[model samples]
Target: MRVTELSFEGFRNLHPGRWNPDGGVNILYGDNAQGKTNLLEACWLFTGGRSFRGAKDSELVQFGADYAKLGMTFEAGGREQEATITIRQRRSVTLNGVSLPSSAKLAGTFCGVVFSPAHLSLIKDGPEGRRRFIDSAYCQLKPAYVGALTDYQKALTQRNAFLKQSKELGRCDSELLDLWDHTLAASAARLTAARQRYIHRLQPIAAEIYNGLSSGREDFAIGWDSPIAEAILPEMAAQWLDALRQARRADLAVGFSTAGPHREDLTVTIQGQAAKAYGSQGQQRSAVLALKLAEATLLQEVTGEKPVAFLDDVMSELDTSRQDYILNHIEGWQVFITCCEPSTALKNTAAKVFSVKQGVINE
Candidate 1:
């Protein structure tokens, strides 16, 4: 997917303006905190109406403004499309002039993979960040996964509340607990199966990309950690139910449901060593870049359209070799990169460079 046009009003420090981007590499260069990332965030909003920076909707509004408005026109799957989002007390989304009931419906309409400074910590950070990476990519490829994830979260929340109440009251209702257990187990089974399949498919792709990034000098592997081991859904559900039953007493004592997909993790290892603990800073960054590229490839493989790439100043953290590898690899996809300086190497490539200053964009 390539964004053809992007417009924003009352967003961060940005003045109301529209950007017409080239289908190839489009570079936005500016000093720090001058709305360069803000422009990329606007493009991200078209994907699923959620900020890749994890900003709250209200926080995206400009100072003294009541609301923020964003519009994007993109080409995906051989068709031109438009999406708009308005954020006030609540957020609203529209596609092709028709109002959408929820932003969840926007999935797959436009998809993108983002790389930012925050992503550099994926290896050093906890498992939650890695898990989020998987879920975010999977949700875009399979929208039904969103429903399953939501249902599982709801059931898990309700189950935890019941556990807390039972612990407080010193008594538990077996029937009520059974209801939640069944729901949780069923949903957990589905989630585990989907995650395992995704990881299995992603491992080789990521490893190959990392190999190229490292010039074939290192070995990389990814593994999924889960409580359920059975390959079949029914068997997995049964295992989950059994595990939950066995852990009920401990869970009650702790006032939470402790055995579920929410507690699972993804492991990245280099040459059989835990990447999180043993990998160097450069290694970790390479792993993350590989993962991001693999995610874009997976999205294209499943969706038949390349997702736009949003690089938020991550190039500054990489060495010259890695930077060149990335710029060379992302040839067919539309890329929006934010950087402080225009690299001399980029001059020979087909790049549309723009300048950002004080919320204004100039070609």
Candidate 2:
């Protein structure tokens, strides 16, 4: 999927602007703290109806403003689409000019790959972030995956509530707890299996891209830390139910449910050592970039569609060869890049360059 045009209003420091991007490389260059990143963030909202920077929907509205609006046109498989999203303090969202009943209603329409400086922490950060990273990327490829995730989260919440309440009373509603246990375990098993399958498919691609970026100095590997692998989803579900029953007392004492896909993690290794502990800063950045690029490739393979790339200050963080690799090797996929200063990094390519300053742009 490629964004052909974008329009934003009252979003962050951006005033209002309409953009037509190159299908290859589209660069938005400006000084630091300008509205460049805000522009890219608006585009990301169309993909998942959420901010990649972890900002709340209302937070996207400009200071002293009450609302923000986003309208984007994209092309997928030679078909064109126009989507609009409106954000307000206490209001619903409109998709395609109609009101969406829930945020979950905004899934699977657009696919994108976003990069920022914060992604460098993917290797070092806690497991929750990494799981979200993988889950979000894979969810775009399969809508069912998103549905499964939603179900799992709902079940997890119910289970946790049961455990919390049971612990507070010093006695449990065994019947209700049993129902939630089975529900949570079943949903967790499905989620774990999907995650494992994705990791298995993603590892080789990530390894190849990482090797290219690191000049084979690092051997990168990725694995899912799930109790059950791809071979047995149902059996694992049954096992998890048993485990949940056995751990009920401890769970109640802690006032929370534990040990399921909600607590699962992704393990990254470099040269057979844990990257979280052993990899250098530069290695983590390269590995994360490779992982993202692999995600773009995986999306293409699954959907026969290439996701548009919205890179936020990513090139600035990479070495010369890796930067060159991204600029030179990227194919027909549309890319929106934000950089603080102009450089010869993109001079060799044909691009549509926009100068941004103080939320205004000269195209």
Candidate 3:
């Protein structure tokens, strides 16, 4: 997918503006807090996800404005298409003049992937971040997967609440627990199978990319760490249902549901060691980049079009060689990269450059 034109008004600290970004690399350079990242955020919002920076919807509106409106003219599915998002009480979307049920419906129609400094948490933090990374990557291609995720979360919440009530009342509801067990079993089984399949597809590509980024000096591998072992849905759900029954007393003791997909993790290793514990800072950064690039590659493989890449302040931390790889080596995708200042790696490179100052953008 390519963005032919993007425009926004009353978005965050940015002044109202319009941009027609080039099909090749587009660089957004400026000092800190000058709306460089905000521009990328605006483009990414068309993907129907929340702010990559974790900002609330209301936070996207400027201080004096009542709402933030964003519009995009993009090329996807072999034709030019349009989408708009208006953020007031919440985000409302219109795609090619057809109002969508919700922003999530924009998935598959306009797709992109983003990477920010916070993505370091995918390696340095706990399992939740890694799980979110894999799921978010898949949800972009199959929007229905998001429904599975929501269903799993809802069932988990109900089961945990019931667990808490039982603990407080000093009473057991075996029948209620059984009902939750069956519900959790189905949702967890389906989600786990989907995640494992995604990892099977992702692991080899990520490993190859990481090896290339590290100049073949380090080996990279990732896997799903899940409790349910069976591969088929019926068998896996049976496995989980039995596990939940077995774990009920322990779960009650802790006032929460103890065994399910929520507790699963994505395991990442570099040079046969846990990247989180032993990898160097550069290695960690490279690992995340490999994964992000793998996401873009797979999106292209599935959709027959390259998804735009938003790399926020990524080059500043990378060494010269890695910087060159990002600035000049990646092929065939529209890339938007932000930095505090341009680097030598950008020298002799053909790219459209935009400078941001005090919320205004200059071409």
TM-score for each candidate, following the candidate numbering: 0.93, 0.90, 0.94
The prediction achieving the highest TM-score against the true structure is 3
Worst 10-residue stretch by lDDT in candidate 3? 323-332
C-alpha lDDT (0 to 100) for residue 272 of candidate 3: 94
By summed lDDT, the worst window of 10 consecutive residues in model 2 runs over 89-98
By lDDT, rank the candidates, best first: 3, 1, 2
lDDT of 2 by residue, 1-363 (tens): 788888888889987878777777889999899889888888888765567777877788899888888788888657887777778865355666677776556556677788888777788889988999889877777767978999988998888887888778889888988899999889888887888888989999999988888777778999998665455878879978977888787888998886788778999998999988988877888778888999988988888887888888887767777777777546688888888775676756687898888998777
**What stretches of model 3 exceed 4 Å from their correct place?**
327-329
* Global lDDT of each candidate: 0.88, 0.81, 0.88
- Clashes (N, CA, C under 3 Å) per candidate: 1, 0, 0
Off by over 4 Å in 2: 90-106, 172-180
lDDT of 1 by residue, 1-363 (tens): 889998999989999989899999999999998989999988887777478778998899999999999898889879898989988988899999999988768877888888887787788998788888888778777778989899999999999999999999999998999999999999999999999989988999999988888878999999899877848999999999999999898999999998899989989999899999999888988898899999898878887888889998867767776777788888888999999997766555689999999999999
Off by over 4 Å in 1: 174-179
Worst 10 residues of 1 by lDDT: 341-350
Candidate 2, after superposition: displacement of residue 298 in Å? 0.9
- Candidate numbers sorted by TM-score from highest down: 3, 1, 2
How many backbone overlaps does candidate 1 show? Answer: 1
